[model samples]
Target: MEIGKLPNDMLQNIILNKIKHFRNDILVRPGIGEDCCAIDFGEYSCVMSSDPITGASNEIGRLAVHVSCNDVATCGVEPLGLLVTILAPVYASEKEFDEIMGQICDTAASIGVDILGGHTEVTDAVNRFVITTTSVGKVLKDKLVVSSGANPGDDIIITKSAGIEGTAIIAHDREDFLLERLDAHDIERAKGFTGSLSVVKEGVIAGKLGASAMHDVTEGGILGAVWEVATASGLGAEIYRESIPVEDITQKICNIFDIDPLKLISSGCMLIACKNGNEMLKALEASGIKASRIGKMTEDKETFIISRGKKELVSQPGTDELYKAT
Candidate 1:
């Protein structure tokens, strides 16, 4: 099952409400629906988030840091530090551990984030190596972009394409299927999408352009990100299915797998809701990122999609096609 939001059950209620005396730090403003925790550090507060790599057998180290950093990017912040933990099965070899750390080090260095501290252990939790990264970033509240800042009539923009992360993982895990339907060149081209599992560059550009709300399209893809932005901002949206940009490789893989590209995971795509979407789109394009105005925030309080002139209401996503493709 997909990981849903943690319910305010008895145990969570005690920790989040009763026991943890929530303090209103100067910079860390406590709020519901924000993806990462905000810390008030006087001059500039820091944003912190932790995420793990579980779906892919390969690229675990590279993806773990980028994914968590993407959460920080959604707020239009630069990730400055990272804490990574590696959990491996007892049967894992030293070579595998070294390779994983190597990937993490290379990726972290590319992004200019320091490896602060983390835990490493070998256990029987599962068969594959699992990597988790907690990324910390700093941003002024005025410069921060929030998902809850979308407003009525704001244009919704998506960068890159849909199904980028999901299709890449699937093409890697299910090589047999891809080899049968796609040529070696096509398969290699598809595998190259691993490098696209980051939206930090695009997020930085959008944040500088003063985007109203920004979200990274991850597990639930572009549609899911749109829903979250709309819900968080107390707004509605009218999205055009045809407006979403899908790559040729993603289209081929999704067609072969019979998956809905819209419901697939997309890490490269950053969803931005902005007052001047046209200007933001131009800024992203100049930065070499493909941006599309897929929809507009509405006052109807309903999220709907238009396909072939027919409008269909959409609910929150479930059973994301990323795992299914794998």
Candidate 2:
């Protein structure tokens, strides 16, 4: 009933419950936190993930690639190719279609991934253009990292800043409104957040460094990702609100909208579960990526957040706050 991702309980009850295992090649089955599905391929496994771009009008092509690739990266897989599907309204013009396809081609080329065949049709089924991409990557069986591998005592690290994607979407989609309240420089900086959407570099580094689990922050934001990671691991987590990074521009925009930056859509940021937080931090920093140890896994199965000297139960992620704005 939400605008973004489906709630956990409803998802399990309605969708995940209906799927039945019929194939033996599926190494990794569907789950809440697991971003990509893995298929057995002997020495190596094929990881695949698909997502659609339905939030913003600008930069849809770039967003589709990064978001789908980020999911495969969560499994320590380097994306090799993509299957893109475009659904545009009947009123869509030829120039607009060219722009979308051009973006998809250019973004895929820059990332060194091929654009495989997919369907494209203009129909009255939707009002605006929607692009969905299924990214494929490969990883050695022994090196595959999973979202359910987090254990007690493992430190939780988050890369980049909270609401990185949400800020960029709002800045670009609502440019006129943002210009009314935010400074021109701030709006420009927020718009630049799109360039930082890809996590392939840091993701590979973290996987090599032996991260127990990795999840890309998406629709529900950082806090939502934490809850999903802990749930998937059948464990608990203690998130320190103060340690989570939030850029000044993000905070300002969130303030203008009266929303929590932590509850917004965040594609650029990633949540990592590992044994040694310091080591992971060092490795990420050496690679020029900003990261912080914001929490640790708990022995008990109860998720909570430490904010302003008070501890409160962390709620399950619902519709992202960004939906209210977009």
Best by TM-score, which number?
A: 2
TM-scores vs. true structure, each candidate: 0.92, 0.98
- State the weakest 10-residue window (summed lDDT) of model 2: 1-10
Tens-digit lDDT string for candidate 1 (1-326): 24533322422365446544447773433333355777777777789888888778877888888889988998888899999999999999999999999989999888889999999999998788888899999988678787788889899999988988887788788878889988878778878898887888988888888888888887667777787778777878999999998888889888887888998878878889888988998898988888899999888767999999999987766566776666
Best by lDDT: 2
Residues 11-128, model 2: lDDT tens digits: 8899999999999989999988889899999999999999999988999988998999999999877899999999999999999989988988988887788988788999899999
Per-residue lDDT of 303 in model 1: 91
In model 2, the Cα lDDT at residue 143 comes to 96
**TM-score, cand. 1:** 0.92
Deviating ranges (above 4 Å) for candidate 2: none
Question: 244 in model 1: Cα distance from truth in Å?
Answer: 0.1
